[model samples]
Target: MEGVVSVNPNHVCKLHTTRSWDFLNLTLKDVGSPQESDVIIGLLDTGIWPEHPSFNDTGLGPPPSKWKGACTGQNFTCNNKIIGARYYNSDNSSDISDIQSPRDSIGHGTHTASTSGGVEVAGASYFGLAEGIARGGVPKSRIAVYKVCWAFGCSYADILKAFDDAIADGVDIISVSLGSPWPSDYFDDPIAIGSFHAMKNGILTSNSAGNSGPNPVTVSNFAPWSLTVAASSIDRKFVARMELGDGQILAGTVINAFDLNGTSYPLIWGGDGANYTIGSSPDIARYCLNGAMSTDKVAGKIVFCEAGLDGSGVLAANGVGTIMSDALIVNPDYSFSWPLPATLISPEDGKTVLDYIRSTESPTATIFFSNAWKDVMAPKVVSFSSRGPSAISPDILKPDITAPGVDILAGWSPLAPSTVYQDDTRSTLYNIISGTSMSCPHASGAAAFVKAAHPNWSPAAIKSALMTTAHVLDPSKHEDLEFSYGSGQINPLAARDPGLVFDASETDYINFLCKQGYNTSTLRLVTGDNSTCNNIKPGRGWDLNYPSFSLYVKDGEKISAIFTRTVTNVGAANSSYTVTFDMPPLISVTVEPPVLVFSYVGESNTFTVNVTGPVISQWPITSGSIKWMDGTHVVRTPLVVYNYLPGAPYNLDSEQAYTMTRESLGLTHSNVYHKTGMGQSRAHPQFL
Candidate 1:
């Protein structure tokens, strides 16, 4: 515990495990451990500290042996017997021989590696992902670490180099935790396009869903070939900090506020005549008031003010507390504390507690610094996670999954220049970090598990395992949290046990390209500049018919199904599952099912959906529906509905379901039948 920061001891139990409750109590031994020779997972983040105790005895130590030159010939030997690492910082001017190839200036790589595939050295957890003390999800797997994130915001250029290098090295699995918030065309995005190539080459890749929370997924790192991970608070518990009287105390067990979608900001007030009644509405009083600004309003009192307000630096400028922004922070929590407060809550609580202070007596009412912080529990998705729809294939599903992100605790480098806030403080060890920068490794770790279990599976198969087997429930609520937490939380154990899979291949993507109307030869020339399109060939043009496409049409209107997935049962190839598509009249939908038949264990299928009405132009007055049928049972596809309305262009209204039965699909069933869509939309644009 030399450099270990101790989060409040009360919350220690929560930190004992990284996975959500649903994924608890599972291990590598429980899941099948296939041959690992074919699985070389890659980590693209801050460089790793191979010298860390975790890989000491495993021979996966620091650079030179672990680190190799960026050149394909020098870096990837295709040996499969060792961990491969490379560094690519544009600012540095050194060759593989001039400087160390695997030296990590930042510790992020080390921590991420420990989480994904560490080799259980001493001082590591006995049962967790990573080799040292902890056992990573894929304990038997090897790794290929690449340093892409630099001291400055990781340049898009460095990331591209890393991607090309990873591919040239022929890594079987690639994981990238770095991303951006701004939107970009999927194909236009170099990283995304590169991931596509990696997948085509039979390399499974995973990226972070980003850490920008409470924001729509309009900004995400999307690649049809990658699994995009989103962060969720495990069990909704985290550490917190409480400042009382003049003494500050490290606190524990704060309230779980990760689900505060509509929660308001806190307001603060201070000094003489500061007496104020606690309002009945806790929602409206989320600000902190303090300093000289409180003189006119509550002279001598402290008024904690909101951070972001219109034309005002403090509450005095606005005069009205409620008119200001959300909760006020007494001071920014720049450096992360041990189990840092799960999130930063309203500063009003601190001001409220301080208001009750008496020179000669202990403050009677201790403002409950309850664990209500959310940022602490879940780090923000970085602004740089590549986003969708694919510029080249806008219709295809990209970024198949989401994982943990936010200020993740990872290895640090005292030698490296400051990257995050804590790094500037000269802290060589623990650092607080956020962004998709922390999410990508999660999927990579998962891919390692998949590769270990299904050595013969293709990149699409691995992605299918993660997505098809993903648990879409919020770890905090133990229920579904869609859009925000795609495919739910990362359940590596479940991903390993995917009963059936919907596998795709390079041919499938080529077919997808052909459907988009791109000539195969022309596409080959454009993507690879060759007559022969390798498995890693980039698609020639955009695909407007991916299953994950969004449809905005007038209410009660019908849409066409231009795309659908073909699923096969590796465990039970002969087992047949009914395939039916249903929709509400408000939003009529159809699919080409004959193309979706699963004739054999590894068979594939395809189809699409086409919206018939204008997008965001004509508003419908009603809602629409979408559903699916599987033989004797009928189930509804989650989160697919919309409707247009008068005066409004397009409104994502509530979902209305229409009945579809096994008999309708030429099958028989005796069970009671009823199905409803969970994500109900309304006729309000703001509701979206």
Candidate 2:
């Protein structure tokens, strides 16, 4: 928490507008109930923008009786909806850009807070795009802003202070959209420690699976007590088209608010107008770096810059427009509106554009903005969303689930620049941003929605409910793996009544920490208890009573891991479930006590799963599932078997290779295999 961390501005009340509500059979009417109004979500981030329309409390009453926090900072006041506001800056480092107040200047905390519990705002849009009645998952829920992040980054000291206060203030759910760049030990991780306390206090914590993704072992929030959320795409996407002078139109992705009025502009390559002041090479100038382009040459002409170039820099040089290429092929479905009209094309299309520019004496193109599109191939996991094989606890899946994170339109701060540039003066009440940061709030809102429905359920029970009832599907129709999506896309309504929940108590997590090698001193620091690991035997990581099953097997090693889990019946009392399982190749799974009979609600049943697998060469991770099927419900848990060698051949350069690794061990694509410098074959996987 106390690192050079950036905010996760990753949504829209587009919650109900998108397939999220319909997919889960949830309605705005259901979310606006009185029970939901009692739920308070503690947002730990930059802060909040109290005046935003989404935070309006016209219909809300006074703060819940359990609230104990207060509004801090000059002129900061909380309404019925935004019941509490507090700021923490223990590092005491004064960054010029950060305002020393509870009011949000970065826009991330405001956006996420509103996304989790904002009221409905009619005609909500980001500069007239994605216009709809924007609201959070549980619109009546209250918000308590805990300012822990600043311009420099979130500090570990500040995060802990906020967590302590927020829990004492009686927040039912904690939504943390901040994370470190890499995995760390639970004792050293601020988020892990803070969430542990929240879990102990019965507050569910939903966290972002860091944006450093599409890579293995990049997940930052791997704590079993927290709901680690991944980002995915919704059906709606924004697209821009480039109409060339030759009557051929090339389709690219961008949010273009500027209109050219059908007039075409002369397109010039950045290399042709290279400025020597910043760099000597015209090739480097093609990247459109600051001072790399000649103002006189690029002025009044559209410039085509390479992938790494900052489009805003070209605009600052008086360039009329930009045709930018992707640095990497991310979610082609998602795009952002720059300060000027720009189109982001894939590298393949970029090559074609370059060829056309070189072939013609004069090249001109017109960029046309398209209305929002609903794609058939949506709900695909965005390439930027972090993947898992949790680096901290390999036995547990990191991202508990994915949510709509790509091109999300949510409430924004009036103080923050719309284009994310310091010089840009444009501002809006709502903005579209993407990241796992955005996905965290969506899951947080959903968790709040479930919490409102079942107020007595424990945090672990709620997390288990979301994971068990989640929809399992990969980006492609084929090759669904838990490493990328965990249990899968969340289904909030289904989660409210997840027939059975893998409930864990504060003691269970303490046991997990004990097994993680935390000594008595470290355990005391984390739990604030005089607890010793003396009585607790070191438990297996796979036996943490989590909703999903994960096992790590090294290459050529035959190992068997047994996981003990307990499930509590939350559904009908007279229920009987038969355990059914699917095994991955090379791994055999068996559930002891194959059938469970429950006589009443809250009846608990314990089961043991024995998994035996041989590490298959070239295959890193493979997945299957175990389901408890009664006549009324099918409680399913994804079973992930990872053959993780310190260094493995499964790492490939393309996304296709990763997909192939999950689907089958055979590699039919030649691009996956590369000759190494040591004259040996290697699989060069793409890292974010």
Candidate 3:
């Protein structure tokens, strides 16, 4: 990736890119055949490296096959050489659809695009997205590069324009590797609205879940329409950095997991500055090593600030002595350092080092503090990513999955414009980068591959394939929380072959809308609002709804929404699978198309369910219980109850069916219903 930028020395770029959990599960053979699947993928980033050797390969070809400008009012041909790139900076004279968008101003875009769809690098191939040498998840997929993000940061309008261009160009997948700190208001932010539109049109939109680590809230891609991806560090046995100590800043030994001051080192409590804060002034805040620097009150030695305080840049700038922090920096250990000294310690070794520095009284009275990345062994989530209870609808799930984020090696511009330079090395070549930005392209490429294999699969089906096929359990994490890893890791192989899926249709969305108290008039109003903003609540039918699988099925008297999912191998197109669902005591779920059957491969099915009760589950539904199941495998949806019954019955003439949903399940409430049959004796049912 290459791009121009507005220089801001204090601004910290988002670290950590998103990649798949099954990055190692794919091989070159899976996508090696040239043009086998002519799916077009849109990359919305700084840009791509049109001249990279990887672009010369059969699968990862040059522009015409790589780029497309098929949208109305747009003339960008899918010509390999057309280069329909655009510069968003006001300083640049370029406008939308300039056909020169292929040029990467910043190396980040190029790297991400390369990782997702790059040609194989001899032995290095196995190191990227999948173990397959010379193959991305979707090697044969064409690209529609949307150069939306310029160094000043992508504007909502720029992002919106990119989406419209990409969608009009008919790209199968849209990958956005950039993020903004601003909150996503429903009325503004055309990018979010545009993403929702893309998904409505069956385009798979993938975005970075932001690099905000360890926080359960950060929502990078808040729009429900896009696949918001979080990042995880690639499990390289060793990650190395240079310790800058004037003459002492030598290349350090590389270790996968290291020990700090014994005590099994970090035990995971390291990385970023989750625990400590580094003062901006030139102060000796803390020290990591005992003898590294002696504190002379007169001759101020160095301070070893904790990792999460300021940032790597700030910590290094103080020029205090050598301080040690977790290795959260995304770039490779280039020969760059702050005026102060610094070194990176592994998370596994953080505790003991902090303990030693604190316990031992060295003549160098440097400050030593033990800052952790939330918990022991837990990786720090990057800061730029958005937090959840998403601004749009906190109840709905936004970031559907998480993937490898740290130190990802992708494509880069061989000759970058100077504005993006932290130094010449950063400016002129392919380097490893991290963040949700990196992870999204990986998914977008994978989506292209999925589209080729199952051309007819809806975005929901594709999403299901990606999520259900993902490896939720990574050996790398300490406790292996699902909140962190999400549907495990994305497994393209399993996704490619996911037998059957729960199909969500337009009606399913209508039901969901109704459950949300949106009637036809209100729905129309919302849709009209979206016309101007392009961001609105999903309305009835297929074209208006955002992502998330929704299936409509028949219930007793009315239609209910039943979300059905398929597992691997258990329910194929030709097989009959017995389906059964038991509702929680208080809530009732009616399954539509309850008896799911598939006639041929790639055919999808659905079930309808009516939820009647409080929005909260009467009893917490364990992971797989409320979800659709095919034999032993289970697919899960972060449960969101859209409907709840009114608490008390009104008088016979009273139209008192309206009620507010209880905030929590633990709250006490009364339930009252009017007696049926007016002629019969009056009777009351006690409400819980």
Model number with the top lDDT: 2
Ranking by lDDT: 2, 3, 1
For model 3 the TM-score comes to 0.62
lDDT scores in order: 0.42, 0.75, 0.44
User: TM-score for all predictions?
Assistant: 0.62, 0.89, 0.62
lDDT of 1 by residue, 1-688 (tens): 5432111111000000133211333454553354543456777765665555444434332322323334222322322323566666565544221224555555556666655665443443211111123444555566677766543435565666677787777677787665643333443355665676787677876766543333223334655556666553332233444334545443433221122222222223322223245331212222332222323443222223232221122333233222111232233222122111122334554334434343415321112223323444232222223232222333343345556553344444445322212212333333334344455666677778767777778776666666655554433432222344444455676666564565666666655555544454544522443333344434322232222333333445554333344454554445444444433344545555522344566664444444343333343222222333334222222223233222221111111111121124321112110000001111100001
Residue 288 deviation, candidate 2, in Å? Answer: 1.5
Better of 1 and 2 by TM-score: 2
Residues forming the 10-long window of minimal summed lDDT in candidate 1: 8-17
Per-residue lDDT tens digits for candidate 3, residues 295-368, read 22212333333442222233223233334444353222211122222334544444444454455454232222
Q: Model 2: runs farther than 4 Å from truth?
A: 1-25, 276-281, 330-333, 475-480, 615-618, 647-688
In the range 1-688, model 2's lDDT, one tens digit per residue, is 6432323221000010133443345667567778998899999888888999999999888988988989989868889989999998776776665778899876778778877788888898877777887778888899999988776667777887788899999999999887865455676677888899899999999988876555556566788999999887877788878877888788776777777877899888788888776664578778777677889888988888875333666876799888887545433545656777777787887888888889989999888755677767767776656677776567777678888777777887787767534445788888777767778888999999999989999999999999999887763452436766888898887898889999999888888878876678767767777777877766567778899988777667675889999999999989999999987566788898999999999999999999886645555567789999897777999887766734322323343444445335332222111100000101100011
Q: Each prediction's Cα RMSD? A: 14.6, 7.4, 14.3
Q: Candidate 3 at residue 367, lDDT?
A: 21
Candidate 1 global lDDT: 0.42
Where model 1 places Cα greater than 4 Å from the true spot, the runs are 1-25, 31-34, 57-82, 91-101, 121-135, 241-344, 357-394, 397-399, 406-420, 423-434, 474-482, 497-499, 510-526, 531-560, 580-600, 604-688
